[model samples]
Target: MKTHERMPELLAPAGSREKLVTAIHYGADAVYLGGANWSLRAKAGNFDRAGLRDAVTYAHQHGVKVYVTVNIFAHNRDLNGLESYLLFLRDAGADALIVADPGILLLCKETVPDMPLHLSTQANVTNKASVRFWQAQGVSRINLARELGLEELRTIRQAAPGIGLEVFVHGALCISYSGRCLLSSYMTGRNANQGDCAHPCRYSYSLLEEKRPGQYFPVEEDERGTYIFNSRDLCLLFRLPELAAAGIDSVKIEGRMKSVGYVGAAVRLYRAALDYVKERREAGAAWEEIVLPPAFADEIAKVGTRGQTENFFSSAPSSLAMLYDRMREIQPCTPVGIVRGSNPLLLETRNVLEAGDQLEYLGRRLEPETCTVRAMSAADGVPLQRANPGSLILLTVDPPLADGAEVNALFRKQHDRQAE
Candidate 1:
């Protein structure tokens, strides 16, 4: 195998402390999170001041970097404690700040001049000129607009080879231009730019003519209303070699509002893909000739999705990118429990777990293992036929967990398969 200096960083989202831990254990090189204020994911389990401090500490102990989002488009009233918050983040040992608004950028430069800054994707940086402009402004890294294609990214990287570039490699896509949309604010009174979006784009809609009161017409023939603006989720697992050859510095997974299972599964799969690409590259394989294992996509399908699309990665997206028939693809598997302890085999149930049922355990560095629920009881040893969501139960398995299954490992059960 040939040698390269570094692999692209696998950046993951951490909506809360548990999610942060899961991302780290699943092999993320860095984690991005939102503080209690100034983050776009106001609905996520953001951290408080004390929590922010502790989160940074914990991530650093695990050799992971933490970038706090202060990327809201601000108003005059929103600037109330802005300076103090900037100082607090700097003092809290945050690695960098992700900012979108120019006012906040200037404030971060003035208030915490020594701290590093990363331009957020919400800034809509689509061209090489925009990349150079931000680079000149003391920005260390820029997450380019998601709408760019692979060739465009290569062009930008060639234009400015000094600065770092990042792109979203997985998760949801927005219909609007670079996630700046007024539909949420106009319809739901929540400003997306200010970080309180209600996701009106995902809502179902039908046409209502002025003359025909109480009459609704479907945009499509389905009984359920049409989803005109719903875009498919992005999955670029197979394109890692191309991205690495393009000199992209980081590949990010985008789900601050998603579940811990989603975070763990995504980070683990992507980590394996990136490593696979690196090894193939080192072995003198051309980027175009590298093919990822098919199981990567099959395993990722276990997590819920609206169907996958390349979205503008290779060329302009077609109408096929929209999910007109349904809101989400039927998930192939459901998370059933989380391993809380291994000594007595304590399991925290996320879904119903019953005796004689088969379960698949998602471990840290190995392929998922299948096991059977031989017996289970309450935490105090009383027998139970089944365990409901949120219950902690002691379990015995037909095939005991392998050597390294630790706390927080996730377990899932496959849904009954149907003929296509």
Candidate 2:
């Protein structure tokens, strides 16, 4: 394999065990995840102690790295619980600990001083001076604030060449700075810093008037409630070459709270893009991004998303309405059938599932897998039986299905489906 500059590490999200596998299988050089505690994503199906051990084992086995998030800003109350947690993470064999608190960093240095640390984006390490300080304090990496631009990132990359620079290459972008927001706690008593963000920014709004005798005006339209603060999904998949060229160590894809299919597709898409870049470099082709076709990316959106966008990159500004519109369906098709069989379980495609259709299974804690349809049933096998919504059918794969793993027998449609 030819090296095109040192290959950028494709860091992806791992919300659960299945997601961890998907991220690795689809193509992630490294993964960042929240533990059951001390992590930013409260809603994700985080790993318990044993689970973390297993996850780390699995990633390391696959020649991938796993980073645990201990990045939550803490208070005096949170400190007492700190030492035990740090010990647990270090014992679990995590690749590194991502932390934001100075006290936490100090404690980590004193306790597990050999444990590698990365400054969280929450640290808002916006300057070379802060980077130097964190490096001196023993932070091995830094996830810079979201507000930084290409120029700022390039400068940091140059200044902190030894320290790994990770960026939010994809996922939701908060309108505020560096995820430090009191909105959820301020409005609903649920602390966002503690992982219970209400996503108040995504909520629609209108002006309420008490003196006007019970009247309301749309905050933006006077009629419709607008998600004025809702921003687009950051899509740097097409800009792989630019980011890689900039000398960033890791291209971090956000979404520890996202679905397995979402995890699988995002990692796979970026992996393909990265490989494409490498291939271009090998062939001496111009290093331009070969993004997955729009329709191809649209398939990813079906997993569930606010629409995707290239946020804050171009500087010229673009309409972000597409991102805010919730009219687009999430999980576009209902999971209507189950795959049943053994001896290398064959997913009896009750419906004509096309190549890229992601198979979702309702497993323990909502864990799902996206197995691309490599081969379907032959004439001797079950056809699209036209069984109703809740039908059970038999099928087979190269390996038999596990005793009880639910798989949503997915089928593609025409145009997209027909081409498949």
Candidate 3:
């Protein structure tokens, strides 16, 4: 049994202020988010200057670190306010900056010399030499490329033990190398490098003969047209023990544009898994002997995904990594509402909620409690049979909520069929 010196930090994504709160509530050690500009997720509900400052303070108050993303590949036009933004982030007390472009890295070094820098995986850091080079440039951490296998990761960790090593333990797997794709630019005039990706890789393709201009043929891989470039979502919940043993410093969940439910669920599940591993290790359990409970993976499947894949973790991935049939898996559970107020037990509906529905409230520490909806009413106390999205409804459950069910605790209900 290989013993790690310390437990790896469980990092989660925060696309918005709400998501940030959710991540922290679910026990993330750190969260990575983007600002209004210069972020790879430009379409996300990113923070402005004021919002960034507030987010930093709020996260710090809760004892969680905040890393801001300035990770877009910059063009001449994109460099206008780069220096000012970097300075602003530094002043806002950001724990670190995640950067991908070499020019951005150089500018950060010059502008915010005291600020910690983390090299983004978009930099395609696959080898130990790249890690060493980045470390030489004052990078405190480096998120390794997603294309590397577990053996390659072990070798890289062995070569560069000084710098903090992080990897995407879960989330959508990009078809291109570390998310540097040109397909969006070529197809929709949106450059992925500049962060306005249209996700052309997820678009289905069909065969069209040049000679027969109007003839369209199905490019079928399995009856669902050819989705050649759509890769499955990555899930490493079962592999946490191995990653910790291999000297990985952080495990990241990759979804800044995902919903609050996704953020909370992923963070909660990973937090529990890491804790389980830590407890076992403290009891002198062998790494090979430690096995995570099946509920961890089962809970993760409730969140939306293209499909689950290990990606390039164990070895070179095959065609099985690509979701050739569908864009995303049919989620087994849908996030129905969020606990808005604990006093009256108010819930702000995210999806439709009916009177007779049963919901599973995701409790802190991953101990979910199920309750049957006995009755529903509007905020104004109007009786209702069904509550639509965005409605603030009052719910009466058979088994009442336990004491200390925190506000913003997510609630979900199972679908009619199982998620594939």
Compose the digit string of candidate 2's lDDT tens values, residues 86-183.
Answer: 88888888889999888889999988888999888888878888888889989998888776767777788888788888888888777677888898
**Every model's TM-score:** 0.96, 0.79, 0.96
User: Considering summed lDDT, which 10 consecutive residues are worst modelled in model 2?
Assistant: 408-417
Off by over 4 Å in 3: 1-4, 221-223, 416-420
Q: Please give the lDDT score at residue 281 for candidate 1.
A: 76
- The residue-by-residue lDDT of candidate 3 on 229-321, one tens digit each, is 899899888999999888899999999989988888888899999999999988989888899987876777776578788988887889988
Off by over 4 Å in 2: 1-4, 222-224, 286-304, 316-420
Q: Which ten residues in a row have the lowest lDDT in candidate 1?
A: 411-420
Residue 274 lDDT (model 3): 94
- Candidate 2, residue 2: the lDDT equals 39
How far does residue 7 in candidate 1 sit from its true spot (Å)?
Answer: 1.2
Residue pairs clashing in model 1 are 2-282
The lDDT for every candidate, in the order shown, is 0.89, 0.69, 0.89
